[model samples]
Target chain A: MSSEPRIFDPDEHDDVHLETELPEAELSDEAWETAALPDDLLLLGDQLRCDATRLHESHRADRLQHELLRPERAQRAETLVPARGISAWLPLLWLLPVVLITAALVSNGQPTVPRIPASPAVAVTPSVTPQAEYSPQVYSVSLPAETPSQHGPSAAELDALLDLMQNETASVAVSL
Target chain B: MKICGLDVEKLTSLYFDRIHRAALLMSGNAWDADDLAQEVFLIVANDPTKFEGRSSHYTYLYGILLNLERRLRRKRRMHQEKTEKLAQRQDGPTAAVAADVPVVSEEWKRSLWSVAAELPDGQRQAIVLRFGEELPYQEIADILGCPLGTVKSRIFHGLGTLRKLVAESPGQLREIPRELGDAQSDVI
Candidate 1:
């Protein structure tokens, strides 16, 4: 319990007070040494590490090579099968020909068969500018007399029709 | 067509290794580090042809790595932080301690790692760079994307904590080096 400082005056052979502050465990003459790695051991460890790394790299390379060489799945054309029966074919068959004929005729400066006007086929209007009730181009087909007579009004009615047609033509011109 | 193209490639390869090693040390795991390295290289390899070689390739790559590391660190931090916050909401103070140590071991290395792991993420990162990788303070700072002073502070504080933990164990403190011992004593 003494607080007095230790003296190291002349003729004093007493040892130095190294134990005062130094922790007992730390005062040992021997320094703490990390386990010395043996030369062979060190070499072996280096070789092992190198081998491990090489193996890892090889695995990585193998995976990459596999990926590089793996055959890609070919993209196939998806063929469509319609759910409905021949009805679907009917529309396509009718539409394709009409569209192609229209396209070809237009391209070649040729006209297709005219559409029929929507009237009873008896009361053909007599307008000179062709006042077709349904289609503007329908009346231009100019049916043959035999065909018209066969399909159209009787001869007795034709005279009456002719007179009526003349009156209608005159009225249409006046209106224009 | 730029720089000593071959030398630049070599320099870049070296830079990549160093940066990857640094990243690995900081992250403490291989997979994360590899991903981080890959990301870093993706940036560097972009227009390697554009490199003017005005600066050392290591310097440029380090700059890019540091930038990316900081960003990734921030993202990881955000994720960990969110998890911590959610855990806290559920369980309070224990959540913090629970999230701290994910592994347990009795080995000295494990003990040291656990103690190091318990430190603030920044201090832990600084110690990994300085002690685990033996990087200079400036480089440590650069890698951690922090100021030199901050890096020093982290290393000093981390070492101080580690020494105290070591001192508390078993018998009286052993003969730690004067240099290392002094660093610990100076702080406390």
Candidate 2:
């Protein structure tokens, strides 16, 4: 069988009078043949039609069975009732997290603990002298005379100590 | 005379089978068909004024069903694409490569219905409405919201594809005599 579709020209039927005017019985044999599709194609169409009809019938039977088994009005009404106990609150449980998040967001905008002003730099300077003995003496001895005044030994005092150490070293060398 | 401002009993008696059958063909499955059929009726029942009497009630119902079917198909396609993309991402580019597998002629031999199912939405719908529902071209055009010429073209191309698929399994053609008899009885 050729796979090509036999095209029906609409123009061929244009000259024919209205369909109601000319019933099948009134048509000539040649005219009827021309109007109808090929026998082979019709057979194919019939086969498809049969399959579709069977499918539809089966579906209808299934639908009828389903409808027959469907829950009655009373059962449906029962389902609509609110569930008991904790299950009843299940719907409202979703709001907990949302409320908590909103509360946290609102609270975060304000400081919880009072922020104390940092201690003044002058107060911190007085505590530094007690720890000065642990400081490297080289840095203190190298301080220039023009260094800024602070709570540390003066450059003149550092020079006098250096002179006394030199004199003691020279006397020990002469005695040896 | 009416249950919901429309003749519920009359509508059920006259159009229920055809509408449900159309739904089945459009959906290609029983579950979706049942849902689509009920939805179509529900829409009609909810607002009888929407009918407008412009065309046959069947056409109006079919129009609604077809529109719903299109949306379902689009959603399904999008889901499939998403799944494919995820698979490619997990398995690398090699997973995305199109398989070179050939169409199995034996599958078409087993069931022509499967081949019909594989057709594009337009072609499948046209074929179903034309052959399954036995609707006239003009009515199909109305339900599909397309021109008469478009309906004819869809059916033509759809049938041609079916014929080509069937031709793939020549051995199956030999079995047509028995099948044809069964088909004739079922169709009539």
Candidate 3:
């Protein structure tokens, strides 16, 4: 046995030394190639390789194949079922825009603010001071004063009144 | 040539058992291992294009499995913490109990595996990848997303831990070879 200091040289080819140090049957090719590692570590590596091989061999490969690798068509069908369910209502989706527009028009036509009561008690009155330059014209519209229980006008009537008021205002401005 | 343009069947055939074994070792149980393996394969199946062939396909698969394992571990840790808190609240000042007991069985491999499972996640992963999967240090480094030296250090420390654990139970050492036993002292 050469007890002399062996220099760390990759070039020094020693097949016999390698064979004696790492038996072919026990250690793997990778373990054999890692010559720099200690013999004990190499032995551990061999043990590891053997253990891994045993574990690998013990697994049920068929079970994995059956679970993971089903036919493409079956897989596609499984996946597409949800999408097909969604697509069944494709005709209904076209009505979305129409429904949305109708909602918008209905909302726009409705008066946002509720009409104030005609009762003078709740009506906000403007205080006027008597002065020669402060003389203002007052216009009064007669109302058929009714109890709060009676409905005043339908929404359509209110809309018609609003349109008539707007037209009158435009005509007065044109005349002016 | 390919399963849905991904060569998944080929990759699966090549590395399925290895991955499953790695998962088994990582999870410390067959049920979790099955779930982990199924999750890994599902990810690969869903988007096979993510594997760009930069590293070996096995390394790529292991990387995905490791990420999934980390997530699973995080969830397990959270659940454990909540359980511990609840336990403390309900049963005040309870003594800590050891999770792993010495194996009464004669099989040293099962004992060894259980001890390996007791190791910290990084060390356990290193040991499993090195010994259980037979991956080289560089490949382990790639799979772990760490430096080569880090991988070596992890394996060394992991093996040292395993050696200590096995030594704790003298009865388990009956099957260990003399040289391997001697090598235990040499492990730094």
Return the TM-score for each candidate structure.
Answer: 0.36, 0.49, 0.48
Among all windows of 10 consecutive residues in model 1 chain A, the one with the lowest summed lDDT is A28-37
Candidate ranking under TM-score, highest first, comes to 2, 3, 1
Best by lDDT: 3
Model 2, range B18-128, lDDT digits (tens) per residue?
Answer: 887777665555667768888878887877777777787788888888778778778866766776777777886644433322232232324456667667888888877
Question: For residues B1-188, what per-residue lDDT tens digits would candidate 3 score against the true structure?
Answer: 45344577777777777788788766755667878888888899888777777887778889889889878888877766776676687885433322222222223255456667667888888878877776776788788887655665566667666655656756844244435553442212
What is the full ranking by DockQ, best candidate first?
Answer: 2, 3, 1
Candidates 1 and 2 compared by lDDT, better number: 2
State each model's CA lDDT, in order: 0.52, 0.65, 0.65
Q: Model 3: runs farther than 4 Å from truth?
A: A1-176, B1-5, B92-109, B173-188
Q: Best by DockQ, which number?
A: 2
Please provide TM-scores computed only on chain A for all of the candidate models, following their numbering: 0.24, 0.26, 0.19
Q: Which 10-residue window in model 1 chain B sums to the lowest lDDT?
A: B102-111
* Each prediction's RMSD to truth: 24.4, 20.0, 28.0
Computed on C-alpha atoms, the DockQ of candidate 1 is: 0.01
Q: Which digits, one per residue and each the tens of the lDDT, describe model 1 over residues B75-168?
A: 8667777878777778766656456542322231222443454566676667655544445655655555655545655654665565555455
Scoring each candidate complex against the real one, what DockQ results? 0.01, 0.10, 0.06
Error of 1 at A41 (Å): 29
User: For chain B alone, what TM-score does every candidate structure achieve against the true structure?
Assistant: 0.55, 0.70, 0.75
